[model samples]
Target chain A: MSSAVEEKRKHQKAQKKADRDAALAKKAELNMTSLMDIFVNVLIYLLMNYSTSPVDVPQSKEHTLPQSSTKLEVKHTTTIAVTKKIIMVNRKKVCDVVKNTVDPSLKKDKQASSYLITPLFKELKEDVQKQKKIAKYNPSAAFKGEVTIVADQDMSFRLLSEVMYTAGQAEFSKFKFAVVKKGG
Target chain B: MGKKIRQEDATEEINIMPLMNIIMLLIPFLIMSTEFIKIGVINVAAPKIGGGASSSEPKKKDEKPPLNLTVSITEKGLTILTRGKKIPEGCDLKGEATEAKLPTVKKIGDKHNLPVLKQCLQTIKEVFPDERRIIIMAEPEIRYSIIIDVMDHSREGKTADKDMFPEVVLSAGVL
Candidate 1:
């Protein structure tokens, strides 16, 4: 038979260890409800904004396009982006825009007041010739004289007209403006 | 006191393990495939420098004179003109008139009165139902959004069956 004192000591040690283990378990329990709520909300928001579009117009704070309800789909063609500080043809920087106008040094004949952007025109002409050459070689890829203009919403009509006129001079007959489609 | 339950009990009110797994797989997939800003296109006529459309010039005497509908957007407001003459605000487009009042639609509280412009165009559409082409001209300082807004207002009515003008010819401001 075991002594009463020895039995009492053994029971006391077992109870203390059980209590410590219970406290540790309680402390380790994690509440996952709040984390799950946040994730679900974010997922729902992202899902709502999903769309399948082919036109990959680079969007930034300074290069936002005007919104419109036109049902016209964006056709892939030569792209000319007119941002706040620069003008790009087919994602290649051609000239700089200062105060909503092409740089004077980049104008035709280097005239400060001339609207024809010489650098832009030259870049567009090169693209046109390349497209014509490709069309000549391959009957399937014919030159359509189409160009997409992705311009900032607040862009001045003067700059837009200059770009349009310069593009026309470069022999791009069909013109299309890239816009953010609304009313979806 | 926060008590830890015994090991062998139901864990949650609703099991979300499957949902979490699906979300983990979908979030990245959707992020790659989605276009947050839907990009579209609006076709506009290119500005021709020398000469354009001999048919509209009316060289032959028997050829009917073109209506030549044009909307000029200025800092003040939108002005609808046909055949080099302005159509008065809230007035009808006569297509061809010898002497008509000045045609200008005043802005409504620093904004172009688009509804009034649409009403005026509706009256003009009645006269020239077959005419689909219209020229748009904007001043140098005019914002590009205003031009797009005006085009939207002039392009269609409440329904698809009632299209106002789809053929938009952009003028180089001088024309």
Candidate 2:
């Protein structure tokens, strides 16, 4: 019994020594400012490179796009104009007039009733052929790239059908109907 | 004194964890905004300049060389032009005798006469059977419905049979 009491006294004395050492270690400080500085530098670098470029949106004074609720911004290399009487594909006029010379005896306005679209098809065919000549990044699928159509709001379905049909024939399946952004 | 010197050395070493975090966020931003490739287009036309430039002017044949056709629709009616020349083949009859000769029917449909347009196309095709296909030009003022009517009839013959589809190709042209 006497020996146990002596051992307990010795353990208590060691505990007091450990407490003093711990108090001295607490006086030593860990600096956090350097770690904070590194974090701020990294954050600034990230923010600088965040948003790179603006969306490409082409507009013209001659044509006003129809109103639509779509959010997609078109990125077309070629801009097609749908005018009051002419369809300009990449600034080239393909069909100038619709006429019928045969059977002048039929009527004075027989030619006007008939619509012709041969030149536009030829132009589209040419475009497709030219793209195939370039090296690298060939689109094997149909409706590739930005094809913006500035179709007039009043154009007849008959005429529009021909336009859509022609575009489809040219392998231009993807289409963006140009429209003014609401409230902009 | 040796222990104090060792502690100072530990404080001098830089922490790199924050620098690594910033790089991760920046990479996604650059990739999302980038447009790497653009599709190229080429315009094709009939070869105009041949070597030695065939200077000889060929005699005018009775048949006219193929001319581009343009059709414009307005509130008034459809206007037709061929190479800027006026052509009137599918209009209403003028004389009273022609009106009287028309077949009497209970209904005169509002639907545009497709046959009239087809007949006009037929004549154009006959003149240039090998090259009858044409690009259709119309004004935006024209109705979408009317334009479809015109194209449906632009073919020289019956469109019911796919085999007999008139080879007319449609195109849009600026006024």
Predicted model with the maximum lDDT: 1
For all candidates in order, state the fraction of native interface contacts they contain: 0.70, 0.09
True lDDT of residue B36, candidate 1: 70
TM-score of 1: 0.77
Error of 2 at A2 (Å): 99
lDDT of 1 by residue, B29-53 (tens): 8787677777888888776451222
TM-scores of the candidates, chain A only: 0.74, 0.51
lDDT of 2: 0.47
Across A132-154, the per-residue lDDT of candidate 1 in tens digits comes to 89999998998877899999998
Interface RMSDs of the predictions, in order, are 4.3, 12.9
Q: TM-scores for chain B, in order?
A: 0.71, 0.41
The C-alpha stretches of model 1 lying farther than 4 A from their native spots are: A1-50, B1-26, B50-64, B94-103
Candidate 2 lDDT, tens digit per residue, B64-121? 5656554444343444445655455443222232333322111126444545555655
- Candidate 2's C-alpha runs over 4 A off are A1-62, A97-116, A135-146, B1-175
